[model samples]
Target: MHHGAYPRSISNLPLLRSTVAPKRPIAHSPKSPPSTCRHYRQIPEEEYRRRLAEARPLLSNRRAKTLETIGTTKQHRTFILLCVAAAVVFYFANSQKVPVTGRRRFNFLSEDWLTIFGVSGDAYEQELRREGVRFAPKYDWRYARVMGVMQRLVPVSGQADKDWKVHVILDDGAANAFVTPDGHVFVFSGIINLCGNIDSLATVLGHEIAHNVATHSAERLSAAIIANLTSGSLFLLLGLLPGLTLAGLWTLTGGRYVQSLIYDLPMNRKQETEADYIGLMMMAEACYDPRHSIGFWERMKVVQSQSRGYEVPEMLSTHPSDGSRIEKLTQWLPEAMEKWQASDCHGGQGAIARQFRDALSHRRFMGVAWYIAVPGDWRLSIP
Candidate 1:
């Protein structure tokens, strides 16, 4: 408010300031002109080296631990050696000879164990009843037809003393027949229709019976156990390698598929072939014409072609090809014919003998005798 002279309070007041600031010129040192580098606290060389040395051991320990987690070379070698030794011991311990074929194979299941826990015929029959599956009555023609052939084959099956029971299942969709080790035979209606005659039916029945006689089910179970162990071991071994895991191995290896292709399928095919051989011999010894087997297999081949529309390669299939079966049957026909001729089938009190007598009696008493035009064909005759 005062220009030159003012009031006492006004003269003692603080000075008024302007809003704008005045500019100043910058100065630079000659030796280090306008330094822009960041400043840091300096450390002593000895202290830094000591700290680095201490950290090296920690880093080394971490690296060693990671290596241990993935398994070292020595550990892997030791584990693999142990696996080989265990496998060798297991193989030798379970080695046994197959009946009839005399082929040595691995099966660790004992007879007592098989009896108690194995597939039981009586139990299976009860299960079928529970499931409401119908069985052909004993008085039915199919039942009699199956029984007649089975009776003739049983005496020569090497287990005649066993309480053998045959049931004809009313399933027309399943062209299959199977027998339990305890002498229970199940014949499907579809297979009966497929057989077309008793001799061909005998071929099918003899094959199924041979499976029981050979104890293939128990062998298959044992093989499954071995396969599981092998697969688990393989997965574990693969996971121990660097950058691998069980899930990864499963995805990459297709473990179950590999095991089936390598072990299970081949084993099944082998068992099937052996059963074919044994069944052929058994049918021949029972005085059923063995040559019918070849024709039956040819018919089976045609059926399979129509149903599946495409054939699976022999390597991938559980059973051998129909061609393979026919070839083997043809090769074995000479021996089968010799056995048939030696049976003296015309004079015995066997099922075939009874059938012959019935035929003759029908001709004499009824003045009419039905005969199958085909040599190996089956036909019913009443006396």
Candidate 2:
């Protein structure tokens, strides 16, 4: 054929002409198998379908596993970042000093937070009422007596004009008392029954008031919130760790109860001691003999032993045991007495003592054995 006629015929033949065009060469390693040879090798349709069915499961499983691994890795990275952020927040938030004790502590609660959520004064009182906590009448003599003790103590706690209201809770046989963050005192009649005299009563009221003055309730709330956030975040972080199960995560984080028992309870006990010391000074400053605390706690020990069957060790208890409490009060007695003697309301205000004695007339054990107060003197001795 002529050269021009050959060219036209070649270009017109589609398959042969397209196959001859220059294209970029695919790179292949020298060690790679010769797969180019397999492109020419044809298998029967049934065999190809059989091979595809067998490989399909394996490929699907591998892709699923790869996706799961990537998702888990991303989840772990997110949790780690969250924990780091929480740690940074806690560090920057920092600590505060207690007003009453002048002791520094790890407290991150801001005044606004305390005002908004921490100080549930009226709310807590209403909650208690809803929970069947029978409150003594505001005009009741027992209530008045408790209020009297508070009146004498609050001013000395450096809380002048503090609208500190005392509400006497007459719970059945429960010797417990608590003060709210915004200065609402809930005194139990059982605690009054437990106390020997006005001074012992002063000890109870003063301690509860001191808890308010020091903002212990708010501090505890703040600590618990921070701990819960930290521990929960940390637990999520641990869950992301490779090969960790739910049980393993709990073991690693120690759970919320364990954290509260280890971190929060110990801190609570410390706050109790601080309140004790501050309360002792308050009672003394109010002209109530500090030594009466010994008799009061001794009676409490007897009551607790009879009721609770056994005392929880101080280290494990939220409040120091009766023995520890009495011992600590004893340690501060000297200082307390000095403050009492210097108090303008010194000598226990004989008229107030008379009213206290009259209020105690119903009790059969109202005698020197309960509280040994020297006539016309603030100094007290326990028999």
Candidate 3:
């Protein structure tokens, strides 16, 4: 109580000893922590129990719901992935390689179906013939010449079932020619007039035939079917709204249209380029000058320029532009020349055929009578 000594007042009355100041409570340093844990320790047991009782059910329910949501999401993702895998397998299985170019393509549509659509049915060609003005006396020498060219090309094309035939639609104004999927060739007389030489005509013929040989039409049809089905299924799977509103409907349709334009059009343009390459080879093998392909496309460029509104940009159009076609042909000319020189038929025949075609194109005959009236030597002649 005083100086390091116990008070003697323990024996005496305790109040009688000198009064001692209560020891001051120790001051806390700034760096030292306060006894915060004491506040929690001071809480009553009954209150702690009550709080735990209130929180347990909520925590358990949240945990259960989170686990359930994760399970459901995994299930949905698994199903969507399985659907995509199946579609991929089906596509790979159905694809086939195109001849000459060896490009893999879809062809679920059968040749029988194509024949029914183009060959057996009187709808496509017959309807076209009926609607448009055609050159009469269909057996004219010009047609014969076209048919002759077809005969040469078909043998060289190496198509196993060669049922190729040419129908000369002598529409003097329509400068186009095309081959159907079923081997029906339509040659507009306008093209005949436009072709500067027989080789140029053969170039056009070979190109059209190459389109059929490559089976581009069937590929396009198959792609359209797959694209429609796939896009529809994807939107359905997504649960995207396809409602009465214009915006909803557009959302449903717009994706598919953009998808087709992005995927389909480029593929179509590639098919055109493939056909050009094969056609150049075919013409060369048939003893037609592949170099004249340049000339033909040069002529087409002139025609395309004159018919400005009729043309579309190469990126948008199915066919490559004339300049592109000519450039490609020029690039392949050396290879084509090798094939031409190796051919059994001499290229000189092209020159003579050009002369004969030039002369015959000038003559205007209304019927087969005039066709016969043409010199017999000229009809049978070959250089």
Candidate 4:
């Protein structure tokens, strides 16, 4: 109970003081309850500005991408405009008038260029010779007949001054005649048999001659060049599209087929019709009967019908159908007769010869009529 007990009691007094500490009550306001939901604090001005600054580059990149897309679209438009401009210039620059028919056409190849290209009959003849194609000798009747018809036709062909050469191919199976650009005429022996008369032979020779005078070969070559260029450009432009592949574009466009159907075959048929008109006029000018031309086409119809058993649609062929040719020839016959009557053939003995020739032509025409009427008579040869 003295001073030592006092020190021990002081240490115990700390432990007693810790265990008996008084607790204070938490204060609550009547206006608000303790919130169970989260409280959202507004972002500070500096923090908001810092986030905006960080996003600014992303917004600018999006604008740049939009501008780039607009620029690319403008470039594509400008390129298309340029191509159109070029095509317009090219069309006007190469425009020309076809001979005889006097129809407007597009031919960029000059005569010098055509000659240099060797698209002439002479070149074709040489090729034929190399291929061992037998040709009738000058002394042969078939060769003489072709030469005789050509001699009369050339003077009226408007290209009389050109070096004219005639060769009769010995192949009787090929019933065709063609003239080269450089004044070379090739006649198949089979065509002569089909003609059956001198006036009918004249029709064929005149047509071949008209082709040369019209410069059809040069026109064809020039057109081919243009068509190829157009198709190639189309292919390239179509290839630039996003979803289209090259193989898909090729299958879709079918450039060659399109060119053939839309351009080549149609153009060839047009040239053929033009040649027929020009040849009719030439034969009339040469004092040949134009009615015989109709007879010849009728015969051709019978032959074609018999051989193929089915007629090709006119659109699918390079030549006009026999019926079309006959119809046109009939339409043109009156004009040709007027020309023929104006010629020297109507004077003195020439008139008598024409009457006799016309009588023969009428007989031949009747034969063709009989053959056409008897559809069952397949045994009737054209000759």
TM-score of each: 0.64, 0.64, 0.64, 0.66
Could you give candidate 3's per-residue lDDT for residues 163-265 as a string of tens digits? 5556676566557776666566667777788885789889888888776655566666667666655655554454323312333665677964565457766
**Which residues of candidate 1, in runs, are more than 4 Å off?**
1-84, 97-102, 115-117, 233-244, 251-253, 344-383
143-253: candidate 4 lDDT, tens digit per residue? 877777776776555454467787787766656676666666777777789999889998888787666666667677777666655544554453343213553666678
Q: 1-383 in candidate 2: lDDT tens per residue?
A: 11000100000011111122236555745686656654466899999999888774545777767645642566665866676686655544445445445566654443234556553557767776665566898778778788777767755664443456777776547666766555566667777787747898988887776665555654565666666566555545544333336546666787645765776667767777887887787788788888888898887788778776766776665566778778888887887788778778842332322332332222111121222222222211110
Clashes within 3 Å, all models in order: 0, 0, 0, 0
Query: Of 3 and 4, which scores higher on TM-score?
Result: 4
TM-score of 3: 0.64
Ranking of all predicted structures according to lDDT, beginning with the best and ending with the worst: 1, 4, 3, 2
Highest TM-score model number: 4
TM-score of predicted structure 2? 0.64
- Looking at candidate 3, what is the lDDT of residue 96? 59
**Weakest lDDT window of 10 consecutive positions for candidate 4:** 3-12
Give candidate 1's error at residue 15 in angstroms.
99
